[model samples]
Target: KISAIANEYGLSVDLQTKVWQLTVGQQQRVEILKALYREVDILIMDEPTSVLTPQEVDQLFTTLRTLVDDGLTIIFITHKLDEVMQVSDRVTVLRKGKVVATILTTKTDKPSLARLMVGREVIFRLEKSRLERREKILEVNNLQALNDRGIPAIRGVSFDLFGGEILGVAGVSGNGQHELAEALTGLRKSTKGRVFLGKKDVTNSSAREMNDLNVAHIPAERIRIGVVPALSIRENLILKKYRHSPFSYGEFLDNKEIEENACRAISDYHIDAPSCETPVKLLSGGNIQKVVLARELSENPGLIVAVHPTYGLDIGATEQVRQVLLAQRERGAAT
Candidate 1:
């Protein structure tokens, strides 16, 4: 979050370096330092604990409490009910761009605060379950890929994605998971070995070819590569299938068909756009990702390559995405 603000202010130090090398508390401190270094008077942080552990969150709250005592105004943007109750002094609940309520935190608890935040009664918990086992759906054989600097990003990594399992790739960031996802999605070409998808060799396939073969991709950096910023939401929705049949009529352009398709995608994805013609650049981060996921998952693809799928999304929206993926997996889709 600080990285975005620092980029806005044109701070020169490397954000990647800070994220790669620092501890959780140290990383949060770097964000504070980046704000201070850039001479930012108003610090805005959004959903800060999405990546942090419990102990690290406590340390960060301590730091934030100290900073608040020092008279620094932090516009902490968060949807985590417990965090709001614990850290905030005064809470301002905004529902659909309007401030619904603003009250002292001392008088409120998590449930009361969440009710104000959403303007409805909300459940703030999850019910756990054990999943059933199934057959292996994907296999990676000695796959290798290079980073932009020509260094080996993923070194001989092999794994199997089962039909009815949510196999987690657990690690710190930049530990080759991003590259692995890219390689699997055919966005990043592999240099060695092959990727087998149910008896087919897809190692050297392009993203378009992979999509044709039922490979869907949700990129990690959606703002950079997922959507065209200058295009309208409707235009961006049909990007993957514009040149194909039904969306296109021989050589002549089908603007009406394109509009219909885009509207369908927007409605199916539940994109909160005022109109289909609105530019995607105006949507929030979660909404933008919703568009990408909608386009990718609509085809009921055989393989889904999700890179940080829940990043920057609210709990409800994240759960929605998770349910979609799980439903796909249950229907024999591989990840």
Candidate 2:
């Protein structure tokens, strides 16, 4: 029965293959097949395309339409407004545990929906003016790194980033993108070559040293590298600056200064939280991303290293993040 449902949805799976070896898209298919096998009338998917590539998202959408045609009802819960517009027949907007509006997808536009969801006017697009490229501020010379298994991941990669420019690194998963970002941010050691931050050889420097040099990093994994899950938003905001002045005195932290910073960040970044004292883990994914952005970008570093900055964000949040990056670039920060 599972095989039949899989075939009907245009899903291909190997019964002999272990679940751990399956791709993310294949795992999603398996999940759908399990629900179909149980003869459920409705299927609910939460942030289904959060980790998928463009092609994978298209494939998933095709399978969803096929299932819907076969009399299966699907409820896709996602922050991505574009996906909702493309797939949903009717859309429901919720804010702070209350239904704001329920309108037909064909009747509403992205801006209108965003306003309903955020309770304020949202900018859908950003106007980015071109800036004359400045001298190279960061340079990676034949950088190499190893993955967690001590296997070679990055090999002899080199690049130069200039002020007033955004250099985008694109590649398939496991092609050393993560390793490269980590090495550049000093989170991982380079096996060869050197990294120059404006004539300073900072290769294999500690994370603290990189931060002290005014380098900001927005990691791909928010829960793991971005913020502490167990800490409050106020506490997490001061993670990097707690030992410095204003936030600390001698060896003790200044709670009042930390709280003030958190409150200011929350307002400036438009982070939706009950209070600055709220634990970061309890906030939604989009809100957590806002916290990370607020903390990193607020520092106004000389260079910004961002990995998938808008990976799991909604259209509104994605636009905000992009604008922030653009603003940093305009301020002569190499992004």
Candidate 3:
């Protein structure tokens, strides 16, 4: 029955596969199958494409269309204007808890919808001009690293990132991208070869050492490595510099300075939070990403190592993050 319902909704999965082993898209299909098994008339999916790739997102939309045709209504909740415009017939814009507008998708556009959601006109893209490539700011030679399972993930990798160049490492998930980023940022130990930040050899250095050298890292797993969920927004903002001056003095944290800095970052980054004292976990995924970006980029580091920086962000937040990264590069930071 489950298999029949899954097929009916254009969802197909190997019955023998465990849920843990399934891809994010497959897990979504399983969820839909479960709902169908219960004979639900309506399905509500919140940020359904948060963890999916572009191809998976398209597949999800197709499946949703099939379900809709079969008389199963789907209420798709997302902050991405493009997805809403592409997938939905009638659009409902919600700001805070109130409905701002309810109109046909064809009648509205990306810019108009963005204004309704944010209450301001937003730039969707940052204009990036070609820069003259400078000398290598960071170099990794024959690097090797092991995963948590003690299996080698990164092996014999070499790269050079020049000043004013945005080097993007593209690959599917679990393809050693995380390991490479971790190794570069000193979060994981490299078993072989070297990493040089400018003239300094920084291989196998501690994360603190990297920080001292002005190497900013926006980790892949935001909740685990980017920010502490239990900590207040103010505390998380100073996670790396809590022991430094202004934020800290004579082994004591300056609460006043920290709070003020947090407030400034919240405003500068357009982070939608009620208070700086709120726990970071209380905020939505997009807002949490904003907090991480605000803290890392505001430091004005020499080398910025960002892994999946725009992973789960909405269209507006993603554009903001990309702009910030480009701005960092324009400021002569090797990203």
How do the predictions measure up, each by TM-score?
0.80, 0.84, 0.83
Ranking by TM-score: 2, 3, 1
Query: Per-residue CA lDDT of candidate 2, range 1-335, in tens?
Result: 77777777666677667675454445666786788789888999988777666676787799889879889899999888889999999999888789989999999988898899878888776789979989889999899998765778899999999999999887645568888888988899989989999999999999999989989999877987899999999988878878899998998888888989999999999989999999999998788999998888877888999988887787678878898899899999998
Candidate lDDT values, in order: 0.74, 0.85, 0.85
Q: Which 10-residue window of candidate 1 scores lowest in summed lDDT?
A: 5-14
lDDT of 1 at 207: 83
Order by lDDT, highest first: 2, 3, 1
Tens-place lDDT digits, model 3, residues 132-198: 9987899999999997657788989999999999988875445687789889888899999899999
Q: Enumerate residue pairs that collide in model 1.
A: none
> Whose TM-score is greatest here?
2
What tens digits encode model 1's per-residue C-alpha lDDT throughout 83-124?
887888889888778998898989888767666765566655
For model 2, state the Cα shift of residue 139 in Å. 1.0
* Candidate 2 local Cα displacement, residue 229, angstroms: 1.8
Superposed on all Cα atoms, the candidates' RMSDs to the truth, in angstroms, are 5.1, 3.5, 3.5
Inter-residue clash pairs, candidate 3:
none
Question: Least lDDT summed over 10 consecutive residues: which range in candidate 2?
Answer: 20-29
